[model samples]
Target: MKTHDLTSLLEAMFHQSKEMILFVDRHGEIVYMNAEAEKTLDLSDYDRNQFINICGHCMGMAASGDPDCTTCFLMSKEKLTFQVYMRTRYGKRVTYIANFQQIDPENNISVFTLNPLSELMKQQEFEHQKLLTQRIIQAQENERKRISRDLHDGVTQELLNVLLEMRLFKYTKDREELDEKIEDSEEMLSHLLDYIRNISVELRPASLDDLGVEAALKTHFKWLQKQYGILVDFNTNLNKKRYRPEIETVIYRIIQEAAFNAVKYSGSDEIMVNLKEAGSYNGIEIHFEIEDEGAGFLMGAEPKGSGLGLFGMHERISSVDGELNIDSEPGRGTKVEGYIPVGERIV
Candidate 1:
């Protein structure tokens, strides 16, 4: 393209682009700003008599991951690109990615451009939530299949056996034989009831809602020992304390998942679990920890199983507006600990 045509195209883009563009002289004066910059920046506070300075809009320059502008970017013309917090039109400080470079050495002028960080963050959050939803759906499907298989293989088959025994009992020739058949059928029915109850408890233990998280966890730890060879060194100071149903559920499920993950992948025969209420200056916080010394995996490595466990652990904790931290390393132990800001329950 001819130089004249190219200049027009560039000028058109400079005005029409969504990003904010500004031209600054070495004196820190704002020579020009795009329409977006005028719309987004809080330039009203600055004096119009004296030229508006870029410092008026910039709260700080974020460099090397630090938000503090220890060294001013305006002083250096290093073809820099970094995060900056700029004052917005509404008197709020918003983060933006800034690209600045000296374009006119003779005039000591530079071009400064800004792209809002909020837009990029919003897009990232949307993608994260989309992935989380997909994983949750898949987890639910797997759980349903597990329950269905348990009913079919365990409860249903056993019930069928009892039904056949009853049908044969009526054809028994001797009184003693009939009595024995009836007893056998009763025993089978009793075992079938236990199997159904186990499945029900796994779905959502009634103890979790009725007795609270402490009781539910105690019961669960015992079951964990029986179901898996791994023993849980359980300790708690909850003392039958009650919490919001949602809080109780979140704590129980997180610890449960952490322990199960330990059992499946940690290669440890024993795990330690602690639930305590500690006094904090603000209020009281409920703290819990699950630790196991086993074949821990790298934090960002591909999970041996579905990565949904860790994702669900985070998702569950976040639902209660709590904090969580997981520490693990290869050949070292894993510790999953966090606190829920319940403080002391208000009387």
Candidate 2:
């Protein structure tokens, strides 16, 4: 672009851009402001010829602390881009992303531009959710791989062995040999059946839909003890209560993941799980917790294992308008707890 055209374009943008643009001196005296700035800010407090107190309109530039004017933006010579809170015509303190740059060194005149913080946050949230959705899809695919491996390595191999044994039964030298082979194959097949059943439960148990969250969890805790020797002390006052299918699934899955994490990482032999109505008068939500007095970790430290399990638990709970909170400290017990609102409660 030619210099003359570039100047015209810049002039048009100064008059057209919706951002609150202002020119101020090093002493924070407002020199010039765009039409947009005049429309948004409450300037009635300051007279036209008076050295303006920009502080009245700007609450403060956000800093590491409480936006304290410790390091005033106007006092600095370097250009800066930061978040700032500014009062508007309606006396509302709205956050704005601000840019301050010295345009005239001799005069100490700087151009300040302000854009609403909400627009940036909305864009960032969209990107974050997009990444999260992709990760969840990957987690589901990994789960499928796990189930497939278990069936192939444990159940399918055992079944194939049984088939080979049956084929050789006709060639058995005597009745005693055939009888012994038959017994051995029967035991092998029985174990394979149990293994398959375990995988099926891990995928999505029918009991969760047929019975409810409480019953499903009881069976799960029992299985955990049987399979991993990790005892789960389960207690519940739900008393055969029922809920919407989706809500029940979310509750069951969140508890399941938490208990599994405790078993895998807690190093403690026992875990306690509590399930009950949360509110005293209304009982409008259900609260469940999985806790273990084990070797807990720092609250913000890196996870011992892949953090996908914890992330998935949060996603599951959030889908049902629930809240999940985790509290743990080194040498202190870890507790994974949450509440699921029960608007779809069924008797």
- Number of the top candidate by lDDT? 1
lDDT of 1 by residue, 298-333 (tens): 998988887888888898889888899999999998
lDDT at position 306, candidate 1: 75
Residue 323 deviation, candidate 1, in Å? 3.6
For candidate 2, lDDT tens digit of each residue in 99-144?
A: 8888899998988899999999999999988887887788789878
Worst 10 residues of 1 by lDDT: 42-51
Name model 1 segments beyond 4 Å from true: 1-16, 22-32, 41-63, 67-94, 97-113, 279-284, 300-305, 318-322, 341-347
All candidates: TM-score: 0.75, 0.85
Candidate 1: C-alpha lDDT: 0.87
**Clash-forming residue pairs, model 1:** 284-343
Q: Name the runs in model 2 displaced over 4 angstroms.
A: 1-3, 42-53, 170-174, 283-285, 319-322, 341-347
What are the lDDT figures for the candidates, one per model?
0.87, 0.86
Error of 2 at 27 (Å): 3.1
